[model samples]
Target: MTDQIVPDSEHRGLVARLPQVPRDLAQLARFDRPIGWWLLFWPCAFGLWLAGAGWQIGLLLWLLLGAVAMRGAGCVYNDIVDADLDRQVARTAVRPVASGRISQTLAWAWLGALCAVGLIVLFQLRWQAQVVALASLALVAAYPFMKRITWWPQAWLGLVFSWGAPVGWIALRGDNWEVLAALYAGCVLWVIGYDTIYALQDREDDALVGIRSSALRLGGRVRGGVTVFYLGALALWGLAFWLLRADWVALLALVPAALHLGWQVASLDPADPANPLERFRANRWAGALVAAACYVVGNA
Candidate 1:
């Protein structure tokens, strides 16, 4: 297959992230970018903590590694499917596949390699967790086509990206359906909120390319839509705590995260796409705060 990653030669300020792109295939798997992995891993942490306290640190570490590998694998798979589209997006044009840094065949090989690592991590989980984990493959496989078929591709992303939450509960208790459902719901809404912000950055490109996304769907109502989703996330999280015994302290973390999301919306300049991307990426801190809440509640 032809490579489609467009190369940009403007080397100034933040435009230079590509200059230091890792040469090693391993690093190119993007283990260096912890945010993607952190986003994936957070739901798992919350689930594990909610199931019970004092999780094995080593198990958590392995899950982090799993998150890194699986997220990279997912990105590679997406690049393969959307290489042409990525070539057209300013923020994605320099991606490895779009820039010709990685060929299609090599990308497939790398994808398989990452899956192998993912498989090893899966093996470390309990039988129930393994089963829950395998159930996500279909969601992940269909993710690339979501934007083509639905305005809310980010909703589909929530399902795939947050599958770790279900596995987290299974990894610990194997049952407790209520908590699992609540966790999954919270994660889904969380993804929609942040991913809508992410989609804002590509609204023009997506419109030109005939891709659908929440950013396009919400349009001028992005702040309103994001507020709805963020509130939904908080609600589901509250439900999870209620199902898990409504630990009041766990609800406390929602304050800061809510304030942050509120600030993101209130101060949002949707016309300025960069603001949305910055706000979207800032979810790392939000995830951390929620994870802390779970740890405190679970441990308490």
Candidate 2:
């Protein structure tokens, strides 16, 4: 049963210690892979920091909790929806839902619990932010079907995952919709680029299963496609900085993040089985760099 753990689980030891049912539930929510939550949390931080909410540690912590719970809920929902597709993909075939380790009923119950946690976090924000956050539900609900209907599901995911930016911005201040728009747009592109890297791991299986992704659409030009997206993200972020501060010094804040993204693209190896996941996971740091840049530009 321990062997059923997914290959990329970062906390296999912790997950392996759980009882069978609990372990399967944890696997269903992808609790062992913290990357998803981190990715989800960063845009929140980007929005908060860029909105000049200086070190609202308590609010940030609450948002972190929300990120964890909501990311888990999203994964559970995704697994429930994608179980049939998962069964066809080599990497996802052993997933708890697809492998029959967990039932859809149990998964829905778990999703409800996770969303309950998210609901608590939702109350921590202002009413405007609450509405913005609630508005994301429709996007979240639609995401599972994007790959079925379009080649750019990652673009839809970008919309879903980058939503936190607006919520965070609204929570801190109501004005500067232009700044929020630029920041949110950058976050969307960043998600599309990193997720495209992640999708590389499943290209063969996804093609066989008739699933669509930016990775499949780019084909041999995946590196270039990611490069274009990353460059677009940086350009938009730069525009956000200019709109807010109008300083070349403020634009300089983006340098570190730009260099990091450049490294990810320049070093990317799509053909190497291990390489894409490595690069994909590295976006956690990439996101952190951008967050730090946001902090600098917004606070300094």
* 171-261: candidate 2 lDDT, tens digit per residue: 9999998999999999999999999999999999999989999999999999999999999999999999899999998988889899999
Give candidate 1 regions above 4 Å deviation.
1-28, 247-250
Off by over 4 Å in 2: none
- Lowest lDDT 10-residue stretch of candidate 2: 24-33
lDDT of 2: 0.93
Tens digit of per-residue lDDT, candidate 1, span 1-300: 112212211122233343433432433455545567888999988888777848668888888889998998998888889889878877677677777777889889999999999999999998989998999999999999999899899999999888888887789886669878988999999999998987887888889979999989888898999999999998898888777775676678568778877887787788874687678768888888777767766667
lDDT winner: 2
Worst 10 residues of 1 by lDDT: 1-10
Give the C-alpha miss distance for residue 244 in model 1, angstroms. Answer: 1.1
* Residue 201 shift from truth in candidate 1, angstroms: 0.6
Q: Residue 106 deviation, candidate 2, in Å?
A: 0.7
In angstroms, the error of model 1 at 258 is 2.1
